[model samples]
Target: MRKYALLISLLIIISAINLNAQDDNEKQLLKQFHSITSEEMSGWLEKLCSPEFNGRLSGTPEFVASAEWVASKLKEWNIKPAGDNNSYFQWFKWPYTIINETGSLTLNLRLSDGSVIRKNYQYPNDFYPGMNSGSGEITAEVVFVGFGVTAPELNYDDYKGIDVKGKIVLMNRDVPHTDPRNPEYKKWVAYCYHQYKLENAVRHGAAGMLYVDGASANPNITYDPSIIVCGIGPQPLEDIFAGIKTTNKALIEKIRASFKPASFNTGKVMTIKANTTRVNEGRACNVIGYIEGTDPVLKNEVILIGGHLDAVGNAGRVVNGALDNGSGVVDIMGAAKALAQSEIKTKRSIAFIFIGGEEVGLIGSKVYTANPSFPVGKSVVFINLDMVGNGTGFYVSAGSSYKEYLKYFEQANAKYIHRPMRTAAPEAGEYYGRPRSDEVVFRTAGFRTMAMWTTEATKKVYYHLPGDDTDAVTIDIMEDVAKMIYLALTEMANDPEIKF
Candidate 1:
C-alpha cells in the first residue's frame, strides 16, 4: 500500500512539472508570435517589390541577389544550411528571356474603297508583349483556332479544315473542357498547358499567335525561333471578331456544347512584333535552410514550408509581384524568424525553402523533389503559400486526409489569430491534374501537400500585370498568416504522436 501511494505521488508531481513547462513554453511562443507584425511584413513586401530585385525573374542576376538576401536572413537567425555542399542554394539550369521593349500590335482593317485602316493597340491596356516570344515580327492574316487544341482521340481538332500555315492563329488559353470537378476533365488536361497550346500552334505551321489572355505578362510558353506571340485583350479580340456572326464567348460555348472544330479565317490581318533576347546559359536556385529538432528520433522527421520567390520579369514594364508571391515569401520569412527565435524546443525538424522559377515553370520544385535535401518519405507535410496577402481570412487545402496535422493550425487560428479559417481535402489517390503550381509538382513527387491562401479579397488583384504591386497586399492578414504558421508549425513539430 505504501509503495503504491509513493508511485501515485510521483506521477502527480511529474504531471505538475509537465503542466508548468508547457505553460512556460506557451508564454515564450506567444512572445515570438507577437513579434510578427504588419509593419514588418509591409517593409518586407516593399523591399521585395523594389526595383533592385528587377521583378525577381528566375535565372537573372537580380533574382540571385534576392536569393542571397533571403539566405542572409536565415543565417542571421542561426538556421543551418540544408542546401548543396553545405550552402543555402540548390542550383538548377533555368534560362530566361528578356523583353527589350513594349512591342506593338496593329489591326489592319479593310475598307470597301480599296483603302485600308490600321488600328494600333496600346501596350498594357489592349495588348501585352509575350514574355517568351521569339525576337522580330510577323505580319499575317489571323485564323481563329478554338482553344488551340488538337486531340484526335477525343474527336476534337481546332486546326481541322483551317489552313494556318504561315499565318497568325488567334486562340484562347485553356482547353474546351473547363470544368475541373468532372472526371472527363482529366481527358482534356493535356491540352490545358500554355506550352502545349503554343507548341501546337507552331506544329500547325502558324507563324504568329495572339493569345486571348488580356494584357497580362505570361512566361509559361514555349519560345520558337520562327514565330512571334502577343497577348491581346478584349479590344483586339472584339476587333478580330467584328464581322463574325458569333462572339468569342458564343463560339467557345458552341464548341464546348459539342466537341467540334470551329476553325475559320477572321479575314483580319494583324502585325505582332517583339524584341525578346533569350539567355540559355542562366542558372537559378532554391534557398533551403533547416532548424534541427531536440529529440533524436523525431529530429529525422522534417516539416517543410515553401513559396515561390520568382515572378514575371520586366515585360516592357516591371511586374511587381507583390501579392502574387512576394506576400507568400515574406510570410514564410516571418514564420521562419519566429520559429528560429522561439525558446520552445521542437521535437521534429523544420525546413524553409524559397523556391525559384515558378513563373516560367515549376523548375525549382522539380529540382528539389528530384534531389531533396531531406528524404521525401520522412517529410511530415509540404505547406505551400502563394498569393496569400490580399484577403481578410485564411484557407488551407489538402487537410482532410491530414486532420491530425491540420488541428494545430486550427488551434492557432482559434486561440490567437481569430480569423475566418477554412480547410479542404485533397482529391483522393494520384493527382492527374494540370502541372501549374509548385504544390502540384510536390504532390506528383509523392509528398502530402498542404497549401495556405487568403480569402475575401480586399483589393483588386492584378495577376501577372504591371499593377501587381504592393498596393494589392493586405498586410494585416499577411501578419496573421505568418503568426499562424509560426505557432502551428512549432506545435506540430513538437507533437510526437503525429502520423503520416
Candidate 2:
C-alpha cells in the first residue's frame, strides 16, 4: 500500500512538471506571434495602396509618399535606422523614363502589283515602340532574321546570305543563335538567332529592329514602361521589349483586312521615325524595419525576411504584385510583427526588408548589398517570401540551397497546424518556371537564401496585372505562414549552435 502511494505521488509530480513546460512553450509562442497583428497588417496594406502613395512607382510622387509611410512604420517600431540619411529611407539613383505622347509612322506598302498602301510600318496596332526605345520611325527593307541570335560559337548564322546592314532586322524569340546541327549544339535555335541580330544589324548600319511573335497572344499582356528599372548607360528594358510581340491572330487579321504583309515596303526604301522616353534621373527606395532581440551577445546578427516592394507598371499602374510580392510582404510583415510582440526574448536580430525594383531584376536588393549598413556577408539566412498569399493552391516550395531550412519550417508547421506543405526538388521545380525576384541577387552575393512562392493564386489569376490587388489576399493563410516563420525564428534564435 505504501509503495502504491509513493508511485501516485511521483505521477503527480511528473504531471506538474509536464504542465509547467507546456505552459512555458505556450507563453513563448504567444510572445512571438503577437507583435504584428492581422489588424496591423491590414492597415499597412491599406496605407501602401492609399491614393496618397499613388501606387508607389519609383521616382514618382506616389513613390515618395509610400516611402514616407514605410519609414513612419519603422520609426513607430523604434527600430534603429540603417540608412545614413538618419531616417529609414534608402534611396538609389536611376536614370531615364519613357516620355510618352501619341505619334505614329505611316506604312506605305509597295505590292507586287506595283503600288503600296503604306510607306513605313506605322503606330498603334502595327507595332508599339519598345520600352524606352528611342522615339523615331524607320523606313527600310524588313529582313526576317529568325530569332537573330548571334552565337558564332554555335556556327549558326541566320543573316548568312543577307547583308542587313542599314536595314531593319526582324527576328523571332528564344531561338538558338547558333546552328543546332553541331555536335555541341542542341536547343535554342530561335533564341540564339536574336542574340546579336539587332546589334549586328545595327553594327552593319542597320537602322533598327522588329522582332515579331515571342509566343502566343494575350491582350492582357503588360508592356514595360519604366526605363529606370532597365539600367543606366545604354541598354534598356524598353529596347528589349520594343520589338517583342506575340504574332497573335489579330495581327494577321489586321494585315489581311486593311494592309498587306507584303506591303512592308519589303525591298523599297522609306523613312522611319522612332521615339522613346527614359527615366533619365530618378530615385528608388527600399523599405526596412527590425524587431530587436533580448540577447545582448546575439542581438546584432539577423535573420532577414522580405520580398520585393516594387512591381512593373502595367495599365497605368506598376505590377499589381499581389501574389508576386504583396502576399510575401504580408507574410513577412505578419511574422515580424508576431515576433516583435512575442515573449521569446533571445539573441540575434530580426530584420524585415521590403526591397524596391525587384521586377526589373532585384535592383533594390542589389543596391542594398552594395552599401549595406549591416555586414551583409553575415546575413547567414534570408527567407524571401515572394508569391505565397493565395487560397492555398500548389505550395510549389523550391530552393535546394536551403533544404534544411525548409525542413525546419515544415516541422514547425506540423507541430503548430497544417500537414506537410507541398514541395518539389529544385530541378523538377525548374520545369514549372524559373522567374527572378530580389532573392536571386542575395544568393548571387554568396548569401544562403531561399524564396517562397506559389502558382496557386497565379493559376486563378492575379499574378501581375491590375487584378493583383490586396483584395485577393487570404489573411488566414497569411497568419498561418506567419506562425510557421515565427516558430522557426524562435527555434533558430534560441539555439546557441545554429549560427555558423
Candidate 3:
C-alpha cells in the first residue's frame, strides 16, 4: 500500500511538470506573436515602394538589388540558405521588355463632308501602353476578333471570314467556354495565354492589336517586333461600337451560346504608337531560405511559404505594387523573423521563398519547381500569399479534396486571431483553371497547395497601377496575418504525423 501511494504521487508530479512546460511554450508563442506590429510592417512596405527599387520588375538591376536586400534580412535572422550552391538565389533566364514612354491612341472619325475628327484618349484611364509593343506606329481600320482563338479541332475560329491583314485587330482575353469544371475548358487552356493571343494575332497578318483587358498594365504578353499593341478601356470599347445595332455584350453572349464566330469590321480607323526596347539576355532569380528542423527523421519534410516580389515595373511611370504583393512579402518576413528567434524548435523544416518574375510570367515558380532545393515529394504542403493587405477579414482556400491540410490554418485563425474568417475548399476541377498565380505552378507540379486572401477590402485596389502604394494597404491586417502564419506554420512543422 505504501508503494502504491508513492507511485500515485510521482504520477501527479509528472503531470504538473508537463502542464508547466506547456504554459512556458504558450508564453514563448505569445511573445513572438505580439512582436509583429503594424508599424514595423508599414516600414518594410515603405522601403519596397521606394523609388530606388524601380517598381521591382524582375530581370532588372533594381530587382536584383531588392532581392539581395531580402536575402540580407534572412541572413540577419539566421535563416539558413537553401538555394543553389548554398546561396539564397535560384537563377533563371527571363527576357523582359521596357516601355520607354506613355504612347498615344487616337480614334479617327470620317465625316460625310470629307473631314476626319480625331479623338485622343488619355493615359491609363482610356488606354495603357503595351508592355511588349514594337517601337513604331500603325494606322489601320479596326477589326473585332472575338477572343482571338482558332481551334480547328474544336470547329471554332474567330478569324474566319474576316479580313484582318494589315489591320488593327481588337480581341478579348479568354476562350468562350467559360465554365472550368466542364472538362472542355482544359482543351481551351492552351489558347488562354496572353502570349498565345498576341502570337495568333500576328499569325493572322494583323498590323497591331488593341487588347481589351480593362485598360490595365499587363506584362505577360510576348514581344514581337512586327506588331504594336495597347490595352483599351471602356471609353474606347464603347466608341468602337458606337453606331452598331447590337452591343459588345450582346455579341459575346450570342457567340458563347452557339459556338459561332461574330467577327466584323468596326469601320473605325485608329492609330497606335509605342516606343519600347526588348532585352533578350535579361536574367532573374528566386530568393530562397529555410529553417532546419531539430528532429533527424522529420527534418526531411518541409513546409513552403511563398509570395511574389515582382510587380509590373514602369509603364512610362512607376507602378509601385505595395498592396499587390509588398504586403505579402513583408508579412512573410515578419513571420520568418519571429520563427528564427523562437526558442521552441519544430520537427519539420520550414522554407521561406520570395518568388520573382511573377509579373512577366510564372517564371520564378517554374524555375524553383524544375530544380527544387529539396525533393518535391518530401514537401508536405505549400502556402501562397498574394495581395493580402487590404481587407477587413481573412479568407483561406485549398483543394476541397484535402480538408486535413486546410484544418491547420483554420484552427489557427479560430483559436487565436479571431477575425471574420471564411474558408473554402474548392473542388480540383473548378479550382485549377488558369495558370494565373504561383499556386497554379505548384499545384500543377503535384504539390499540395493553399492560398490566403483578404476579404472585404476597405480601400480601392490599384491593380498593376501607380495608385498601389503603401497607403493602399491595411497594415493592421497584415500584422495579424503574419502572426497567424507564425503560429500555424510552427505548430504544423512540429507535428510528426501531419496528414496532407
Task: List pairs with backbone clashes in candidate 3.
Answer: none
Rank order (by TM-score, best first): 3, 1, 2
For model 2, the local distance difference test gives: 0.56
Candidate 1: worst 10 consecutive residues by lDDT?
A: 424-433
Per the 3 Å backbone cut-off, how many clashing residue pairs does candidate 2 have? 71
lDDT of 2 by residue, 90-158 (tens): 788754344354234343446679877653332333444443344555666655554454555655555
> Which lDDT values do the candidates have, in the order given?
0.89, 0.56, 0.89
The C-alpha stretches of model 3 lying farther than 4 A from their native spots are 1-9, 427-432
Candidate 1 per-residue C-alpha lDDT over 1-500 given as tens digits, one digit per residue, 9 for 90 to 100: 99999999999999999999989977898999999988988988898889999899999988998899999999999999999999999999888888998889999887899798999999999999988899998989999998999999898899988899999999987788877779998999988888999999999999999998977888878878778999988999998889789888888898888877788999999999899899998888999999999999999999999999998888878998999899999999999998999988799999999999888878999999999999998998999999999988998877456766678889999998899998767642233357668987898898888888999998999999889999888899999999999999988998868876
The better-scoring model by lDDT among 1 and 2 is 1
Q: How close is candidate 1 to the true structure, as a TM-score?
A: 0.94
Q: How would you encode candidate 3's per-residue C-alpha lDDT over 1-500 as one tens digit per residue?
A: 99999999999999999999999999998888888888888988898889888898888777888889899999999999988899999988777787888889999999999999999999989999998888899999999998899999999999998989999999998888888878888888888889999999999999999999988889888999999999999999999999988777788888889989899999999999998888888888999999999999999999999999988888877888998899999999999999999888899999999999999888999999988888889998788999999988998887666678777777888889998888887632223377788988988888888888789999999999888999999999999899889988988998768876
Worst ten in a row by lDDT for model 2:
226-235
